[model samples]
Target chain A: LAKTTQPISMDSYEGQEVNITCSHNNIATNDYITWYQQFPSQGPRFIIQGYKTKVTNEVASLFIPADRKSSTLSLPRVSLSDTAVYYCLVGAFHSGGYQKVTFGIGTKLQVIP
Target chain B: SAVISQKPSRDICQRGTSLTIQCQVDSQVTMMFWYRQQPGQSLTLIATANQGSEATYESGFVIDKFPISRPNLTFSTLTVSNMSPEDSSIYLCSATGLAGQETQYFGPGTRLLVL
Candidate 1:
């Protein structure tokens, strides 16, 4: 499994866009970048996933660099409820099974009113 | 996406006691996982419950301490044996769909407080 590093914390005002980046210097060839959000007293919720380039969904967007060494999760028009810890994971895809990825210290985003 | 549920949302147990957490999924899943999260910390995977076989535990975790049972595809159990104050933490259950499914869903978690 590839190790990931992210900022310890970030602050953003409501209605502003927040971008959290994660770096995986030794990302594998078959690795896919995924992000998750976790609120207090709740399980982590899947946000967005991407292999390369940009992938957007209704909730968030993921941008990956050409080298696949890093990825960023962008949350648009953040609200107070969006304040949560975000985790970035790099999972290696196997032929017939799922590989577990380790969780690192996530980026805590606080949305201020 | 899979919907996962765990039994005994929270419990306070005395030292040397044991607590078994039950995890149920709304649909059949191919992979089931157990995790521990200490207060103000990130999640650490405890083990993977493999159906019809023994569970695979991660380093620093053992079956004697954290025994897991996955009888089928929809349900599993994890028992924290001989609890102590240091064992107090939130236990979470996670699952993934059939083969090739990348998304993993999680349960609300069972809060265990050992006194």
Candidate 2:
């Protein structure tokens, strides 16, 4: 399992783009960077995932550099409902076996009005 | 993504009591896990519910306290034994390995409040 570090908290205004970065300097060859969003009183929801370069979904986008040591989750047009804690995880998932996922403190993004 | 559901959405139990949480998935999944989230904190994985075998617990968690049962591919149960005030937290169930999807899908958590 790879350890990940992220900013403790960030603030963004409504309708602005929010980019939350996570660092995993020891990321392995098979590791994939994934992001999740958790609102109050709810379970964490998957946002986006990427191994390298960029991967976009209906909800968010993930950007990974060539080194694969870090990844960023970009949420476009933030709203108050998007204010939540975001978690970045690195693991070798869907390998036909059990993969252990570790969750960091996460970046609490507060979408201000 | 799989649609997961948990029983007893919220409960308030007395000290020394026990609470069992049941997790059901709409589709068969290859992996299921139990996690704990204290108030205003991140999630901590308690164990992996392995079908047809005993669950694999993480460090700082024990089967004696957090016993888990995965009888099949789509259903599992977790029991929080001998609860205390400190044991109050949200228990979440998650699953993965559904078809071509690689990310895990989570269920609405069971909120346990030990008094």
Candidate 3:
């Protein structure tokens, strides 16, 4: 399992774009960067994931540079309801027989209206 | 995607007592995971529940304190033994994706307040 680092907290106004970056300098070659959003009292939900370059979804976009040492999750036009803790995880693209994946202390994004 | 549900959404238990949190998935899953989220802390993986076998626990977690049971592919339970004030936190259950992907869907979580 790869360890990840992220901001402890961040604040963003409504209708603004928020980008949360995660650093995993020791990321493995076959590892993929995945992001999850967790609201209060709820489980973390998959936001976006990508190995490199950019990957966009209905909810968010993931950007990974060539180095793959870090990745960012971009949420567009944020709202108060979007206030949640976002987790960044580094793990193998494919687990051979289900490896134990860990989640780090994610960035608590507070979308202020 | 799978729909996961848990029992006793919130419970207040006395010290030295135990509480069993149940996790149920709509569809059969290959693996189910249990996690603990301490106050103002990140999530920690407790163990991986495999049907018909013992669960593999993490470094700090053990089967004695946090016993797990995977009766089948769609159901599992985690029991918090000898509850204490430190045990007051949210317990979540999740299921891994069908393929080897790291995607996991989580349950509503069981909030345990040890008094």
Candidate 4:
């Protein structure tokens, strides 16, 4: 498993774009970058995932540079509802073998209305 | 994506008591996982439940303390045995779409408070 480092907290205003970046210096070639959003009392929800470059979804976008050591989750036009903890995980996309994805201390995003 | 339902959405239990959280998936899944999330902390994998087999627990978790059962591919349960204040946390269950699928869909989570 690859360890990820991200900011403990971030503040953003409504309608603004929020970008949370995570550093995984030991990311493996077979590893994939994934992001999840968790709100109070609810389970974490998958936001976006990408192996390299940029991948956009209905909820968010993921940006991974060529280095593959870091990935950024970009939430566009944030709202108060988007104020939640965002987690970045690095692991194999295939779970058949003997690999497990572990989540680290996530970035807490507070969207100010 | 699969829909997962966890019973006992939230509960308050006395210390030394035990609670079993149930997870049911709409469709049959290949792998089921249980995780614990302490207050103000991140999620930690507790164990992986495989049908007709024993669960594989994490480093800090034990089968004696957090026993898990997988009766089939669509359902699983996690029991927090001999609960303590330290056992107060949100327990979440997740399931993989396929055998090789890494994308996990999580349940709403069960909040357990041991007093």
Which tens-of-lDDT digit does each residue in A1-113 have in candidate 2?
99999999999999999999999999999888889999998999988888999999889989999999999899999999999999999988645554567999999999999
Candidate 4 residue B104 C-alpha distance from true site, Å: 1.0
Tens-digit lDDT track of model 4 for A5-91: 999999999999999999999999999888988998888888888999999988988999999999999999999999999999999
Clashes of each: 0, 0, 0, 0
- What C-alpha lDDT does candidate 1 achieve relative to the native structure? 0.91
Report the TM-score of chain B alone for all candidates: 0.96, 0.97, 0.93, 0.95
Q: A1-113, model 3: which lDDT tens digit per residue? A: 88999999999999999999999999998788888899987888888878899999999999999999999899999999999999999887444244356899999999888
B1-77 per-residue lDDT for model 1 (tens digits): 76789998999999999999999998888888999999779999999899999999999999999999999999999
Error of 4 at B71 (Å): 0.8
TM-score of chain B of 1: 0.96
CAPRI level of candidate 2: medium
TM-score of each: 0.97, 0.96, 0.94, 0.95
Give residue B103's error in model 1 in angstroms: 1.2
Residue clash pairs of candidate 1: none
Models, CA RMSD each: 1.2, 1.2, 1.7, 1.7
CA RMSD (A), model 3: 1.7
Candidate 3, residue B55: lDDT: 93
Between prediction 2 and prediction 3, which has the larger DockQ?
2
Off by over 4 Å in 1: A95-97, B98-100
> How good is the docking of model 4, by CAPRI class?
medium
